[model samples]
Target: MCNGLLNPAQYREPQALADEHALIFARTWNFVGLLFEQEAGQHRGVKLGATSLIIQCDKQGRPRAFLNVCSHRHAQLCEQGVHRGPIRCPYHSWTYDREGIPAGIPQPQAFPEVIADKSAHRLKEFACETVGQFIFVRLSTDGPSLRDYLGPEYDFLLHASAGMNGLIDEFRQDVHANWKAVIENSLEGYHVPAVHNQTFMKVEGMERGHQAPVDTVQHPLHSSIDHPAAADWLVTFERKIAPKIGSWAWRFPHYTHHLIFPNLTVTSFLGYSFHIQRFEPSAVGITTVHSRTVSVGFTGQSPVGAKMVEQIYAESKSFTERVFAEDAAICRAVQQGLECAERPAVIGNGIEDRVLHFQRAYQRCMNPTSPPPPT
Candidate 1:
């Protein structure tokens, strides 16, 4: 935490903020990382709170994760430090085999061959699952499947999650605010008209609300966004998406797959998204948020279709850039205000309740994992 550790009471329990995060987000599937248009053996690096993780293919070509630590002296086995390979530990010539196992100990007879048990020495693996084009890891291997966690929102993101081309167009921004602030900003469309003045004017957020379908779903994992009129419109416009996707779902706790319980919040209208912010709280008062743009159904379908999709995504990105700047400005100012407050409390409205919901949910985990979130 920026100052001392965060006040335990302020959150639900006494553990430090870092510990709580590992429990709620890290151990769970909290958007640990993503698998872009990467090949089976290609490697990519991602961070969870403060830890670095590598996602890559093993010699068997299976996806695996390791602490990125070298076996000999525990030096990081990576360069800057993630890339696909025949990875060679730079510390010593100690080479680890695929699957993160220490393949060989330099001198054969000096060390007992049994001392370097390939199975036991292998890189510690967290259970990994690929959902659509995204990748998720749970520190614990035995839990719900990713879909089981997604619950109801799965109906909406199925197709676009892969896009026709299976790629994600990304935009990253650093905001001087708490990670929670950015997540709260995205939960509801409450700020669309005012917070996004130019964006709203440029795009149409005329209808602002979460879909009723989300409330009714008991459990939905990967879903297709299905709106009758929107579906019809997509077909009507051959110049646009080959298929129409309409909903958002979630995998809970860590990652919201942009559908039901998505790790982040997203709004999609005419393939123009409001924002799906990914926040990294470097310190209590500092956070980095990435506003990633996803190219979906339309982009990969046809040349004309891809152009139209790109045009929409580009326009959406512009609006997001403008409005989010305002959000950053407000958050910066709020941090300064909190510095002086004694016991500050926030007022809540119908839409503002979303933030309260997240905070309450986070608090529940501090002492005992409270009840699972309502279906």
Candidate 2:
């Protein structure tokens, strides 16, 4: 094994970053946002590596995605998400419906040739699909279906996200780091003691608390980690809300972490909450990370008067925000260290198996000769 590490040059080179965009981001199912983020008749602009897309729900509430560039002048239709109606080009009022078919033109008489073949000039569309409450887009037309690409781990993620609805919150910030640094930080729990010692360790009582060792399951496209809560937390929860908690803890058994190939990292926390973190690489050493959360309840609406459930949900959000902040800091620090030639090449121990797994999957995508890892 090469320790599943990329050299410092690989991390800093512009061409390598471009290759990553072409090989990985262009070809995979990238988590965009929760379905609730965009409303019917409204469009949201999202970027996947180098591709820009517009995700909108039609008047009939059907989801659609199109290249954000206008077909006529090639100007971006919208810089940011807008609420109201059909997408209209600011330059000439050229309008398109949710299906990306040209709907209107400022003056049909002025451009007979353009009007004669509107279909030929329709906005390009991308493949869009939803898993649970999350929306994902594939920049390329060809690839395995999102479900097949996700493989068996898709079901586990679906079950863990059952009843999840509208996004509760999302945190976005550009980090001065390579995307791999952010991905590596998320894939391994080994940094919890050092990077998150005061936050997660103190909160979970894992600093000195006796807890079952975390267990992990690996797949070609994904890997998951299941961590049991601290013994004291479980005992107290059982005493207070055993019936409400029911078989959830037993069935779920862990605060699971899944690093979905390409860009999404999802975590199921406390059996009632899940977070999807997307790492979007903007340049060789720049990444934009978005951390989003959703509530697990019927119809994306929180139940009324469920104080304990509310408490746990609120606490989970607070905990994730804190942990994410810690992770972002360390990822940036690692990015800085990676620029030094004297810095040691990366290596993953058993506890960082998911990190290795991610690197393997990434290599398979970026290298023509690298075999796809076992699914």
Candidate 3:
């Protein structure tokens, strides 16, 4: 059995939050948005920790990321949400090209120094990459590539992204809790009986004493849980309709939930649909959960098959929202308790092994030189 590696104070301390923003979030690849959904010449603003960023598609339809602030007077270039047209500064009408270079200056004669070296005044650019439809951004220039950072999850995400046709639903909620608290809650299923008793615990195969067997896979950067589908109706329906919709990827029906290191999770049932969620740290005690559900379809899916997929998506979306609400409420309570807590949390050896795996990874990043915790 392993104990929690993070100190209770780390959840509520301002300085600890700052250290995390710099050491963990900044140095890691953060999930931003879906590349396939963005229109050509569309740009949207996103926040990673305290850093503001703008993700846009260039003329060539390539995804690019840059600091949201204008190079001229430090004004924000675009507001949150998608915008069409050029990346123009609202303050002074300064505009930037796809490569972050200042292409148009209102008065070239006003500042000869800037005109002489336009490259020096370009918007600060960050690293951006995509695997299939998923897009990721990194603030630090020096680090592993997105593939290297994702480790074993890279190939899985690639296949998942390719199968996803489009987004079915999306929402964002600001929770009054530390970001770590929110993520930790998601890494284990021990709370299902209590926190999700009315929702998840009531699922066909998820009843208190009759739950299906679950297998946990742990890696240096990620962890996942796989279990056979317990819902008889869903499993039977999928098996019958899968051939018409697309080639079945797996021999048997199962549910998978994956945690991608720092603060992202991907969940699916039999690869038919994926629920992607990212826990973004907004402040010391505020975290925003950005969630979206995407449907998977094949090239020659029949009309009947498409309608069946839609029905499945509709039910999944409702179930997902209920479970998320339950999780958010419990996470808030956990954060409130941590405000006065002085001891480390206990880690169980069963379902919560993933939680321990995550905490150990966090400790490794936050204290690179420290000796590894005992197994």
RMSD of each: 6.7, 3.3, 2.3
lDDT of each: 0.52, 0.75, 0.83
Consecutive 10-residue window with the lowest summed lDDT within model 3: 204-213
Give the worst 10-residue stretch by lDDT in candidate 1: 247-256
Residue-wise lDDT of candidate 3 within 218-262, one digit each (tens)?
A: 577688887666566556666787656765333336678888878
Over the full model, what C-alpha lDDT does candidate 1 score relative to the true structure?
0.52
TM-scores, each model vs. reference: 0.72, 0.89, 0.92
Ranking by TM-score, best first?
3, 2, 1
Regions of candidate 1 where Cα sits further than 4 Å from its true position: 1-16, 59-62, 79-82, 104-116, 154-159, 162-168, 205-263, 271-276, 297-306, 369-375
Q: Mind giving the per-residue lDDT tens digits that candidate 1 earns over 97-119?
A: 55666665667676575374666
Best of the candidates, lDDT: 3
Question: Going through the candidates in order, what is the number of backbone clashes in each?
Answer: 33, 0, 0
Clashing pairs in 3: none
Worst 10 residues of 2 by lDDT: 297-306
Which candidate wins on TM-score?
Answer: 3
